[model samples]
Target: MVKKYTVAIVASAMLLLTGCSQKSDVDASAQKGAESADSKLNQLGAGDGMMKLSDEEMKAQLIKDLEGKVESVYFAFDKYNITDESNSKISANSKLLGEGKAGELKIRIEGNCDEWGTDEYNYALGLKRAKASQDAMIASGTSADRISIVSYGESNPVCTEHNKECWAKNRRADFKLLP
Candidate 1:
């Protein structure tokens, strides 16, 4: 009876201690979980720290980024063929896109015409100019998803003067990157 009593007393004490320790441990674990949730909430992107990108800023940066990275593509007086220099620029853009320099890139092709051709004809030519660049990009390996085409068709002029220098600037394709 003495031995049985001792064993029962020891077991009862151990059980009591275990139950007490478990409660404290559970409380500590709950505190840790709360801290972790707060940290996560403070994180940016996944939390209130997320930033909103302005469209104007995005457009300006993309245009500037593309400045020398892709050379200006020139169109003929009335024809649209992959000009040697323009083709080279398109090839570079395609290579960059293929190599992952760009992610989900969106390019806008803006075409313009000189004052010579009729608005209707020049508009078609301007579209052809944009399409020419599009073809080059596609051929070089840029997915259509990364590109868009628009034709300003003499409506939007880089230079207002009526001269070859101004005409050259006006008769061109402009590439703008969209976010």
Candidate 2:
């Protein structure tokens, strides 16, 4: 009986040690996995060497990197059709917005007009212009769900001077990025 009791105690201790060692092994593997993920994020520009950014932070960084890179699609004074020159701009913008970090963002297409017509007429024209640009972007492979249109009419002109150049600048569709 005494021998049996001693053997039982020894077996219990061995089982306990085995369980503890398995737990430690699991912990080690989990740590390794976390480190691997962090390294991958760093490689993708989503993290510093030591830490990962939150989703909002990464989006803000992407927006900052992409600012001013997208060119506006300019329009003729009374037309909403996409011109050849405007088509090139739209193609470039679409390519830029369809790849890498920019692909994950939403695009806001702001349509503007010069001070040449009534407020209602300008607003309608601006909306039509915005729709034309949006269609162009979609045709160039950007997702329709990711693009939104807004008409600013004559209220958001980049240049307010009374010249043809200034008016031309105002008659454009601007691109804005959102998280």
Steric clash pairs (candidate 2): none
TM-score of 2: 0.69
Candidate with maximal TM-score: 2
lDDT of 1 at 58: 65
Q: Please, what are the lDDT tens digits per residue for candidate 2 over residues 1-179? A: 99999999999999999999999999998886463546655667534645778889989988877767998888898889999889899999999998987998999999999989867989989999999999999999999999999999999989989999999999999899999
lDDT (10s digit) by residue, model 1, range 96-138: 6555434556778887888886668888899989999998888
- TM-score for each prediction? 0.61, 0.69
lDDT of all predictions: 0.78, 0.90
Total clashes, candidate 1?
0
Q: How far in Å is the alpha carbon of 80 misplaced in model 2? A: 1.0
